[model samples]
Target: MRVLFTSTRGAGHFYPLVPLIDACAARGDDVLVVAPSALEPVLAARKQPYRIGGEPPREAMDAIRARAMSLAPDDGVSVMVAEGFGRLCTAAMLPVVEEVCRDWRPDLVLHETFEFSSVVAAERHGIPHARVAVSAGGFTAQADPLVGPVLDAYGSGIAERLLASPYLTRLPVSMDPSPYDVTHRYHEEPRSAVLPDWWNGAKEPLVHLTLGSEAGALPTAAGLYRGLVEAVGALPVRVLLTTGRHLGPRDLGPQPPHVHVESWVPQEDVLRGASLVVCHGGSGTVYGALAAGVPLVCVPLFADQPANARLVTAAGAGAAVVPANAGGEEPTVLDPDDVRSLGTAVERVLAAPSFRERARALADEMRATPSAAELVGALYG
Candidate 1:
């Protein structure tokens, strides 16, 4: 079988598809990935075969951001998904994706949920297609109404076909609990990488702090990072803070000996040692923490983060400290009170045994799901 995978830019979006892609490749299926040039480095690092697709123009993105920023956070997210991902990104990549489908004639096309171009192209070419989940079901539920109109604009009835396609996910049913006949659960293996030299020497009750790759590059990043640092700095436990690619350790200024700052680290490795995770509540980070049976203190920044945070809290595995006026281009700064609240939440999670117990239950639920390789064999074998 020939499998073609498509994704939008960003690690959060692309990473979810890796397990399925790797599973297909391991089974000796011919696999190709279609993504923007911005994702070249990531795909290259994985040694995955790929083709570059169109990227949305910067001016167009700026215009969209400006428009979305004026509305409330939830409203702003709808605009970003509807106009940015559903419309602009699809319009930009559809031509290249169509060309790839025509030339490659893939037997199956799997796309991350937000990447719509492949869905259209695959449908047009009469190839089987499925959407792999990148966030919780609630996020999808919220996005459908917003993006449905955008997809319908491409062609009448296109939205119905695309939305009704097979849905694959790693999220445990307990975490989402949404009923969808097309949904299939797959086990996503934890990724491994070389840990820092200090990793072995880190103390117990370790805490991991991260805002994901994209959030650290936002305009409000400095305030957010600073707030996170201050919130956890005084604690006696070991704190591993990853600044992502855009910022360096020095950017956060001086830190105590217990707080180790780095540009990036393998999150799975960190989670293994972490007693708690304080993060921006991106689906990847939230799921990783839960899969490891580690609790969280979510500080949602934008996009689907707020929804993810809500799910985490609802599951009794974590707590959230959402930023005021979230989801705007120029969001409000994190004040001292907000920092204190974050610190308190972190302390609360660490002190409570129920959080870890709940997290462990969720982890067990995830482990019960079929492995990605098994899913691949069932689908294609």
Candidate 2:
């Protein structure tokens, strides 16, 4: 079978599809990935066959960002999703995606949730397509109403075709108990990486701090990073803070020997020694922590992070410290009180053993889910 996978620009949007992509390739299927130019380096590193597609126009993105600033956090996210991804990105990529489908003649087109162009192109070509979820909560339901009209403008019933496609997800049922008739759950094995020499022989409990790639690049990230450093640094545990790819470790200024700062670290590797994870509550981080049976202290910044944080807290595996006006256009600047809250939450999670127990239970549940390779066999074999 020839499989074509599509995605938008960000790492969060692309990384979730890796397991399925790898599984298909391992099964000897002819696989091709279509993404933006920004992802070329990532694709090259993974050694996947790929083609670059159009990206959202700069002016349109600026206009959308300007508009999103005026709305509430959730409302702002809706606008960005509806106008940015649903409309602009789809419009930009549809032509190129359609051309690829016409030429490549793929048997199946798989896409991450936000990449609508693939679904439309697949529908146009009468090829089978499936959605690989990137968020932990009910992101599809939230996006459909906002995205449906935009997709319909391109082609009648395009949004319906997207909704009707087979849904593949790695989120354990307990983490997101919402029912979906088309849902197929799979387990993605954790990635491993060689840790730095400094990370070796840490006697104290390890705390991993990260805000994901996109969130770390936001204007509000500096304040949050400083706040995290100051707040978590006071704790007795050893802290590993990743500044994402956008920021340098020196940007966070001087740190004590107990607080290790790096530009990036493989999250799965970090989780192996992490007694607790403090993150921005992106779905990938939340799921990774839970899968590793590690508790969390979520500091939600924007987009689906608030929802993901809520899900983790609801599951009893983590606690959340939401900033004021999170998900809005303006960056979330943490105040002194917010810093205190963050510290208190971390302390609470570390001190309470129930959080760890709940996380372990969730991990066991996740382990029982079918592997990505197994799902690939069911889909293509």
Q: What is the C-alpha lDDT of each candidate?
A: 0.87, 0.86
Model 2 residue 44 lDDT? 88
Enumerate residue pairs that collide in model 2. Answer: none
Expressed as tens digits, the lDDT of each residue in 1-381 for candidate 1 is 999999998789999999999999899999999999889999888866899999899899878977877777688778889899988999999999999899989999999989999988987889989999998877787778877787777677777887788899999997886545688888877776645656457655889999999877677787788889899888778888998999999887887777889998888889877899999899999989998899999998777888899999999999999776565556646788889999999989999999999999999999999999999888768
Q: Whole-model lDDT for model 2 versus the true structure?
A: 0.86
For 43-136, candidate 2 gives per-residue lDDT tens digits of: 9888678988998878888799767756776787888889988888998888889998999999999899899999888888899999899885
Please report the candidate that would top lDDT against the real structure: 1
Judge candidate 1 at residue 134 and give its lDDT.
Answer: 90
TM-scores for candidates 1 onward, in order: 0.96, 0.96
Clashing pairs in 1: none
In order, how many clashes per candidate?
Answer: 0, 0
Question: Once model 2 is optimally superposed onto the true structure by TM-score, how far is the C-alpha of residue 125 displaced, in angstroms?
Answer: 0.5
* Weakest ten-residue segment in model 2 by summed lDDT: 193-202
Query: Candidate 2 regions off by >4 Å?
Result: 197-200, 325-329
Model 1 residue 53 lDDT?
94
